[model samples]
Target chain A: MLRNISVEINGKRILDNVSFEPNRGINVILGPNGSGKTTLLRVIIGMVKKTEGKVSLKGKISYVPAEFFSAQMKVSDVMLAGSRIELNEYTKVMKKMEIQGLINRDFSTLSSGEKRLVLIVKSLVEGDVVLMDEPLGNLDLANRAKVLRILKEYDKTFIITSHEIEVLDFASKVLLLKNGKVLYSGNPADVNESLLSELYNVKLRRGKDGWSNFRFDF
Target chain B: MKGINLIFLSLLIISFFLSLVYGQVYVPFDKIFSLHGVYKTVILDIKFPTTLSTLLIGICLSISGAIMQLLLRNPLMDPYISGTASGGAFGAVLAYYLLAFNLPFSWIIYISPVIAFMFSLIATGLTVLIGRKTGVYGIIVGGVVISYIFSSLITVMITEMSIRFPQVPPLIFWLLGSIQIVGYTDVVILSLLALGLVLVSLRYSRKIDLVSISDEMAYSKRIDPNKFRVFWIALVSVIVGYVVSQVGIIGFIGIIVPHILRRFYGGNTKSLILGSITLGSTILLFSNLIADGSLGFEIPITAITSLIASPIIIYVLVRRNAQEY
Candidate 1:
């Protein structure tokens, strides 16, 4: 479990006085763009140092950044970095991800969806507290569903950030963030249309088939 | 293949013999085996040490270059490019002039390199620290600044030294670099230092690869990027410092060797390290042979490497540009 995280950037509070205890399930930081989602994730994994709180966690943690093109290394090479896994196991993981063809391909050469899959597989193979920044970004519906299935089956603590409602369907809880503050933090089933509409300042209309779209006045 | 290894071994042996033979006065091959006279003394005392030193220096510079490239994650990073060599050169020149260190020196030779190595480490440390706060462009810019600072200091020292000591001109030529005669002690010190560095480098090659990907990625893996970066910069400084003190400045081996090896071996640090050492030593040996053999007067080894490397570098740049177009 990772807990007690507060973060600030350039002396302005971002994750101001925020603390949470993450259990063994999917916890999604449901927030709009630029709502301190990435910053909270960064603080959790010790990438960005927290200002006033300490992060106490057991076991290792793997963080997948929103932008993963930080290295020019090959797919397999980056995944097997500093681990004791053999070559065949690495190949097996790649094959399972259907990214076997991209094993030798440079990280810079992969498509956005393919890179996302690689990062997901990397986090899964390590089997730890996986913190991902928008893991579903740029992924098609099929790939997104495939990744969500994998995350559900892994049975580890998953902290993910995404704006897609379909991606958040499997999330046990959605922490609705607005203006860097958590307005609603509870079961996704309890988050109704009125609360979400007020949080995002948009009229969220629910349709007959359980699909909803937000209508915003510019 | 084992055959290739054997071939490299044979070439190394042949180069060693040829290096001993082709010096100021050519010792006849037939009389090379004789047990008596100046030929034996020259071979045992002078040529042997020079050849060994050349081999060790080549290995050191090349491995250092490979490490620097991986550490900086910059394709263009070299000892000269990062200003380590220039810093060492300044230290040597300072030792020659300011300290009035005499020729055919003993502990002073080691002392000069140690000083230069420390200075280069500090310079590179500062670069990495600033670059971490800023970015890659910042490191490159900082490298340029450090290089200019060391270059001007070298120039000032050279001018001042020339006025005080007439033999300082030859010392300046040494700073330009050559395959001049060195004692066995020099060869041994350099070989030991290079061996130690290579061992440490091999151990940290994986961490180096992590850093190459992204500092943040490395941090996520529980490896402190700052500590690893500082370690690598210090390692490169020591290797560069030792070479510059022993043999002045030999360029391009560090830069070109790693680049060429990368073409064949990909970016796996283990393979890259091995390939750089072998290829670097071969190139240095071949360049030294050309410097010693082709012309009546021995040219500086740096000139030979530059002459060979410039055209190839231009060719690569042109090919890349053409592809872009």
Candidate 2:
């Protein structure tokens, strides 16, 4: 729970006057580039300090950053880090995420997409409220679908910030953020074309498949 | 892994026994346990303490090096990389001058190590502060800078001291690194520090593995990366400080031992700390034996270690660069 949360890094305000309560299901943060989406996720996970306001968070929080860092280590050790969590539980998540086979290999040698999947598996086992920053950014279409399916299936709460609006239908609630402010927050169905167009400052058309097509409004 | 552990144990035992033979009078292996007269006093009082201190310093410094590497996520990190060696030496030397010029009290010399330990922590804190803004390479740079400053100050002090005590050993003796038996106190202190370091390092090994990946990941998983980094860095500093106060400064053992283990054994947390201890004890024991050989006079341990470790450090760095490409 973020109440009037604000952050100033080096001087410039990254997030300002933003308050939100993430839904128990998938909560998608829809915004364009530099909309403070990543900063918002970082703040929630206590990675980025908030200069002003209070954030009361409950339960364990695990995070998977958009840009995965590769350490010179084996994949299995990466998954087993920092927690007394059982190896069996981590392996179960790894298998489900289709990354169990990469366990013996060096993490630095894995492809970017593979690295993201490993981080996802790590977050799943470690967090009650998982915060993912663009978890699906570089993934292929098949992997994207598989991850969305996993998010849909997992009963726990998740807050994800992504530019990919095609999967918006899978998310129960949507928070359209722009210029570090919350423009709209409610059920995903309530987010219409007009709101997205204003949020992205481009003409957006609602297509028949529940996907909105973005076009230059100018 | 089991086989490797067994081999290391055998090497450690062999070196420990062999080290007893070369110091001053040659106590044959058969008479080692059979103590009666001068042989008993030499073996028990003199040789035993020296060899035990050597083994303890190896265990402490090597594990310290391994922990620094894991915490910093740099394979090149060593116990000295935090400036503890130079800073502590400077502090000890400062204590020496204070005693000679001002106090001249016999007990004042005992305070030397305590002052050295304080300086070691200060050096690590400074490095960590610089590292926060700069990253791993920055930490290295910061540590090197701090080391040079301390080294120059120590050199100046040594020159001044040598002018007064003309009959004393060249100040280089303190700088070159040597292991001498001070008393049972050295043995007891080294053993306690070594044991404490090993146990704490093992307990935090898993979290360290995660922290090595990224601070963000560690934080979200309920581990404070900053706190752990400082904790481990301070631990390494204290271990290095304790050893430097006792044995002057034995370089390369910290850096060389960990890399050797990481290559032959691998860097899983358990293997890293454990392998460093066993192999570290063996290597230092061997080096000590060579330093105090059957030769006419004693040679400094660093003279032998630096010659061997210099090439290994270059090889590890070059191989790492190759892997990166």
For the second chain, the TM-scores of the candidates in order are: 0.86, 0.92
- Model 1, B202-248: lDDT tens digits are 78777777677665567777887777777777778887887776677
Cα lDDT, all candidates? 0.72, 0.80
- CAPRI classification of candidate 1: acceptable
lDDT for B280 in candidate 1 is: 71
User: Which candidate tops TM-score?
Assistant: 2
Each model's TM-score?
0.87, 0.91
User: How far out, in Å, is residue B240 in model 2?
Assistant: 1.5
- Per-residue lDDT over A114-201 for candidate 2, one digit per residue giving the tens place of the 0 to 100 score: 9899889988888889889899988999899889988888888899988888768888888888888889988898888899899988
- Once fitted onto the true fold, the runs of candidate 2 whose alpha carbons sit more than 4 angstroms away are A67-69, A190-218, B23-25, B166-170, B294-297, B323-325
**Clash totals for all candidate models:** 0, 0
- The number of the candidate with the highest lDDT is 2
